[model samples]
Target: MTIRPIVRYPDPRLALPAQPVTVFDGALRELASDLLETMHAAPGIGITAPHIGISLRVVVLDLDPVDGARTYVNPEIIWASPEMILHQEGSVSMPGVNDDIRRHARVRIGYRDIDGNAQTEESGGLRAVCHQHEIDQLNGVFWIQRLSRLKRERLVKRFEKLSRG
Candidate 1:
């Protein structure tokens, strides 16, 4: 397993829709391992395949305060409650900034596990928010996208300025 570099915001790849993983081959397994390593190295709770330049519907998350991790392949949000919560969210791709984003407090997700078994998990609070955030990355969406147009523009400018220096 290797730590892969994260794709930054405003990159074209971040806006490209990821393809579904059809073959559970060794390469796919390696990619998952690499993603986990990368996420852990980033000290982040979640990561998506596209974040490492792999445009596939794969994500790794370690929301457990304990020592466990969850890998999701082709994950889909099956259900979400109307009750919402706002949390200050940050991304490894967009360093040095965080924004409060509104998201469902609870969600039911369906996906295949690492062993190729189908499973569903009902998550809430931080888990729910993390899952939704990672899933959004799989679909070419980012937390900043939830911000207002003016705010997004300001962030873009900020990112641009930071990149220059």
Candidate 2:
């Protein structure tokens, strides 16, 4: 598996909605493997296919090193708890910036595994936050888009300065 360069923010492809994965074959497995490797290298908890310029609805999350990684293809949020929680979120695409974004404290998502098995799972806490964050990217919703206008502008400026340095 190889680590693909993560597309930085402002990349047009990052804003475009990802297409669903049509076939679950060896190639899909390989892509998933590569994405996992990339995510680990980024030292991030989750990553989406579009993070590496692949516009497919794929997400990998490895919240705990001991628990192994999980992949979700064509994931869709089926249900979200009414209660919202504020969690600090960031993207590999836009590093060096983080802010508390409000999201559902718990979520249920439906998707297929790499084996093409349909699955639905509910998650809470950091796991839930990570899933929501990555799933947003799959739906063309960048993390910063969840922030207020002023916060978004400040994040942009902060990212600019970090990149320059």
**lDDT tens digits, residues 101-161, model 1?**
8999999999987667789999999999998988998888887998889988887788778
Residue pairs in candidate 2 whose N, alpha carbon or C atoms collide under 3 angstroms: none
lDDT of each: 0.87, 0.94
Score candidate 1 by lDDT.
0.87
Error of 2 at 145 (Å): 0.5
Which candidate number has the best TM-score? 2
lDDT for position 76 in model 1: 95
RMSD of 1: 1.4
- Most accurate candidate by lDDT: 2
Residues 49-149 of candidate 2: C-alpha lDDT, one tens digit per residue: 99999999999999877989999999999999999999999989998889999999999999999998999999999988988999999989999999999
- In model 1, the runs with Cα more than 4 Å from the true position are none
